[model samples]
Target: MTTLVRGRGWARTHPLAVDAVLASAVLVCMVVGSFAEPNGEHGPTWGTRTPDAPSLVLMTLGALALVFRRRAPWSVLAATCAASIVELLTGQPRAPVVMCAVIALFTVAARTDRSTTWRIGLVTMTGLTGVAMLSGGPLPWYAQENLGIFAWTGMAAAAGDAVRSRRAFVDAIRERAERAERTREEEARRRVAEERLRIARDLHDVVAHHIALVNVQAGVAAHVMDKRPDQAKEALSHVRDASRSALNELRATVGLLRQTGDPEAPTEPAPGLHRLDELVDTFRNAGLPVEVALGQVGLDLAAAVDLAAFRIIQEALTNVQKHAGPAAKAEVSVVRVGPNVEVTVIDDGPGDDKGDEQRDVEQHTGGGHGLIGMRERVTALGGSCSAGPRYGGGFRVHAILPVTTAKGGTA
Candidate 1:
C-alpha cells in the first residue's frame, strides 16, 4: 500500500509525462465516480451533480489542470481551489477535486522555499476549510466531514515539505564530502612536489663538488705530463679517486628519481661538518692553500641540518677552486653559537684570475643551482645562508643553520 502511494507521489513530483498520466488517471476516476451510485443513499447521488452539462464541463476543466500541476503548481492550486468553491456554491455534490489541490500543494512545497510553502499552505487550508463550512445546505459547520477536509489537506502539505527538507540536507552532505576529497588530493600533490625538490637539491650538491675536483685534478695531470711524470701520475690517481667517489654518490642520489624497479636509497651518513678537514686536505693536495678553524663543537645537530652544513662548505670550496686564482688562500671556519652553527668560507683570490676557457664551468655557476640548493636546504631545516664578496678582498660564503629541526629535534 505504501509503495503504491509512493509511486503515485513520485509521478506527481516529476515532469510532464508522469504528471500527465497521473492527471489522466485522476480524471478517469472522477468521471467514473460521477456516473456511479454513492454507497450511502443518505447524500445526493453522483448522477445528480452530472445532470447539468455546464457543471460537468467545469469539473472536467478543473481536473485537466492537474496535467500541468508539477510545472505550474500555483496556477493549478488556484484553479482547483476556485473549481471546488464553485461546486459548493452551485449546490452540487463536492467533486473529486481536492486530490488535484493536494498534489499541487505538494509540488509547491517540495520545489519552493520553506517560508513560501508555509504561507501558501496556510492560505490554501483556510480557504478550502472556510468554503466547505460556510457554503452548506445539509452539512453543519462542526461536522466531522468538514474537519476531515482540513486535516487531510494539512497532512499533504506538511509531508511534502518534510521530504523536500531531507533531500536538501542529503545534497549538502554530499557536496561537503566532495570538497574534502579534493582538498586531500591537493595536499598529497604538494607533499610530492616538496619531496622532488629535496631530491634535486641533494643531487646538485653531489654532482658539483665531485665534478669540480675531477676537473682540477685532470688539469694538473695534463700540465705536468712531460715535466714530471711522477707528479702527473699522482694527479691522475686523484682524478680517478674523485671520479669513483662521484659515481658512488651519484648512484645514491639518482636512485630517488626512479619511483619503481629501483633498489632502496642509501640511508647511510654522507660527509658533514665532521668531514670538513678531509675536504680541505683534498683541496690542499690539489695545490690550493687552505686554513681551517674549528670552534669548540660538542653539539649533535639534525641529520638534514648537518648535511646542509656539509653541502654549504663543499660548494664554497668548489667555487673558490673554480673562480679564485691558484695562489688564493682560503679560510674555512665552523663556529658553534647557542642553538645555531655558523660556517664561513672566505678566499683571498683575484676574481679575474681563473680561466674563462671552460664554458661548461661558467654555465654551472650561471645556473645558480649551487646557491639555490644551499638556501633551500637551510630554510627547510629552519635556518639561513648568505654568499657574497668581502669588503677588502675576495668572495665569502656564510651560512647560519639551526641545530634543531622545526619539531625541536636535533637536526
Candidate 2:
C-alpha cells in the first residue's frame, strides 16, 4: 500500500512539467511570427536586420516564468508583464510576452480571491495599451492596429479569470464529498465500540452468578462426604450441571464475534418469564424450598422488559441459594404497578439474622456483583431497583421495569 501511494503521488506531479513545456513552445512560435510581416508582404529588411536580438531575448525570459506559474502565480505574472512593457518601448511587437503574462494571470485567478485578480488584470491592460499607443513618435490618434492591441489584452485577461473560476468550483465540490465520507466512517466506529461494551457486561453477569452457585454446592459436598457419600454425589452432579449450563449461555451471548464460515448459531429460544416455573422446579429438586406467586399485570409488556424481569429474578434466587442456608425458604413475587411491572425476591435466611446484613454485605463484596448488574439493567431501561433487609427478618430485592423497552428489544 505504501509503494502504491508513492507511485500515485509521482503520477500526479508529472503533468505540471508537461504543461510548462507546452506553454514555452507556444511562446516560441509567437516570437518567430513577429520577426517579419505575418502576411509575408514585408520580409526581414537587410537594413534593419532580421528582428534584432534584444526583442527575442526579452520574449524568451517572459516565457521562462511560465515554468513556476502554478507554484508562485503572482511572481510569474509580475515578471512576464514587466518584460512585455520593456519589449513595447524598444520598438518591437510585444505580443509573445503578453501570452506568458496571460497564462500567469489565469493561475492567480484560480488560486486567489476575485478582487485581487480583477485589480491586477485591469492595471496590466491599461498600462500596456497606453505604452503601445502613446510612447512612439507622432502617429494617427485612432490607428486601427494600436486599438486592436488594447482590445486583445482586455479579452485575454477576462478569459484567464473565467478558467480560474471553473477550477475553484470543481475543487470545492470534491472537498465536500470527502468530508461526508469521513463522517460516515466515524459513526460506524462509534457503534462498534458500544456493541463491545454491552457484550462485556453480559459476559460478567452470566459468569458471576453461575460460578457462585457451583462454589456453594461444592462446599456442601465436601462437608457431607464422611457422614453420607450418596448426598455428596448428588451435590457434585448439581455442580457439573450448573457449570455446563453457564458455558452454553456464554457461548450463545458472544455469537456475534464468530468469524465468517463458522458453525451456525443455536436456534433455541432465549429463557424468559415463560420459563419461571421450570427454573423454580430446578431449585425444588435441589432440596431448596421455593414459592412463586405470579400476578396478572394488565398489559403484555415488550420482549426486552419481560427478559430483563426474568434475569433479575433468576439472579436474585441464585443469590439466595448461595448466601442463604440450605433450609431457607424464598418468596418470589411479580406484581403490576400502574404502567410498570415489579419483581420482588425475599428470603428468610441466616445471613439476615441479628442485623448482620451489613456485615455480610461487606464480607461478600468481592464475590457478589449480581446486585450491581441487576441495577444497571433496570436503570438502562428507565426503571428502578433496591436490595436490602426486609422489615422483620430477611433480605428482599425489588425491581420495577417500564412496559416498553428503551429501543424496543432485548440485548
Instruction: Please give, for residues 366-405, the per-residue lDDT of candidate 1 as tens digits.
Output: 4467777877878888788777767786877888887878
Each model's TM-score?
A: 0.81, 0.73
Clashes of 2: 0
Candidate 1 overall lDDT versus native: 0.77
Q: Show model 1 residue runs off by greater than 4 Å.
A: 1-14, 28-70, 87-91, 257-264, 296-299, 353-367
User: How does residue 110 of candidate 1 score in lDDT?
Assistant: 84
Which residue runs of candidate 2 sit more than 4 Å off their true CA positions?
1-11, 14-23, 36-50, 125-188, 228-230, 254-256, 283-293, 297-300, 320-333, 336-339, 344-372, 379-400, 408-411
| C-alpha local distance difference test of each model | 0.77, 0.72
Rate residue 29 of model 1 by lDDT: 76
